[model samples]
Target: MTKTKKPEFRPNDFVVYPAHGVGKILSIEEQVIAGMSLELFVISFEKDKMTLRVPTNRATEIGMRSLSSPDVVMKALETLKGKARVKRAMWSRRAQEYEQKINSGDLMAIAEVVRDLHRADDQREQSYSERQLYEAALERLTREVAAVSGVDEAGAQKKVDEVLVGRAA
Candidate 1:
């Protein structure tokens, strides 16, 4: 409904999607959809070849948000090296929860999932689902970290893992 409050958005602002990492706000446009005029923020993610249009008014409620602060991102990276929490629950159920957390677009939550699922360099193999979730969370978290830290995704991810290693030792 049009009753949703629209937050002020800016071009070049960094945002995070639940499953995707940091993306930039590319443009704001008004489009007529089904006879209703709506304002949308066009976000671009080159890595994923994806462009998302989020309604300006419902951004916050839908979990569309700006990048986290460096300190916040740092805290998330530190979480990565902590011990994993392997629940005895079934994989499908856990996977659904993980997917929800990822889609929430909350950077810290995503980081927590990433941290809890990460396998150390010498750890045994992860199941197909585990590996998929791990990569999804890792990519989502690192992309936001990279945007906030002004580094590339690979470098940001490397730094996060390095920080984890330091904490482990």
Candidate 2:
């Protein structure tokens, strides 16, 4: 077989894992297991202080993907400015849906959760569950926004918050 090429993403490239959000590709190397050589992509999630190794062939199957393009990032940000679209279902049911969206690793879905769960200062307070889900979505969004926009998490958060406030206003 031909020597492994550069692969989809080179070392130091940023990637998004569906369940884990963003992680950096530290390196790609072959490991021996069960007397067979297996190629893996070593990834690091700095914010979570975690490292993962996924089989090179299964990276896409596992939802490992390159970071969103700037245009896509802009679309995700614009998603935040949309009006909240809360379903009329029960709280438990709605919570499940929001969790699915957040874990989907799709920026637009995460943005929807943020917009729906957001509570303007004058609005009624959110329940504990709502608050937790909202924060998770916000954090996930902030990380991606920061990576794509070349800003720190705090800076990205400010931009997101500004958009939310403008929408609320």
Candidate 3:
């Protein structure tokens, strides 16, 4: 077994947990689990109003990461302006893929989902599940964009909208 390395994080630092979008580290604390003391990172998701405690050693393994860089965010926004690539598979299958992408904590993957599932004004509407998946992906993308760009959620959303509408600035 590989030795669990200590994670490099501190309180109040923003991090991306794979299953949760963006969260701030509340504090690092120790707790006894099955007679063994364990070190954990307490993370709070303000948007979800939830708190999660994860083993500090497990953070890297579980895909917890620092915020994306500006260059990466710009690349994801560029992805938003591309053509949608809906696969020929069934909706259920496609939906599963989209769900995975949204929770993957990879900005580009989430951006692809937003681009693929976006419905333009002239286009037909999406199914309920499609709408849900699209919104989830958009929300994840928006949060990361907001955190990286230092913009509010509304501003981040507007920026995404402008790109989707072919008026990216």
Candidate with the greatest TM-score versus the true structure: 3
Evaluated against the true structure, the overall lDDT of model 3 is 0.92
Query: Model 1 residue 41 lDDT?
Result: 89
Per residue, candidate 2 scores C-alpha lDDT tens digits across 34-95 of: 99898899999999999999989788776778888889878888888888898899999999
Q: Rank the candidates by TM-score, best first.
A: 3, 2, 1
lDDT digits (tens) for residues 117-145 of candidate 1: 77777878889988898888888887888
Better of 2 and 3 by lDDT: 3
Candidate 1 lDDT (Cα, 0 to 1): 0.80
How far residue 105's Cα lies from its native spot in candidate 3, in Å, is 0.8
Please identify which of the two predictions, 1 or 3, would achieve the higher lDDT against the true structure: 3
Model 3, 58-130: lDDT tens per residue?
Answer: 8998999999999999999999988899999998899999999988999999999999999987889888999
Question: Which residue pairs clash within candidate 3?
Answer: none
Candidates, ranked, lDDT = 3, 2, 1
**What's the true lDDT of residue 130 in model 1?**
85
Clashing pairs in 2: none
lDDT: which is higher, 1 or 2? 2
Cα-based TM-score, every candidate: 0.90, 0.92, 0.95
The 10-residue segment of model 1 with minimum total lDDT is: 160-169
Assess candidate 1 and give its TM-score to the true structure: 0.90
* Candidate 1: residue pairs that collide: 6-57, 18-102
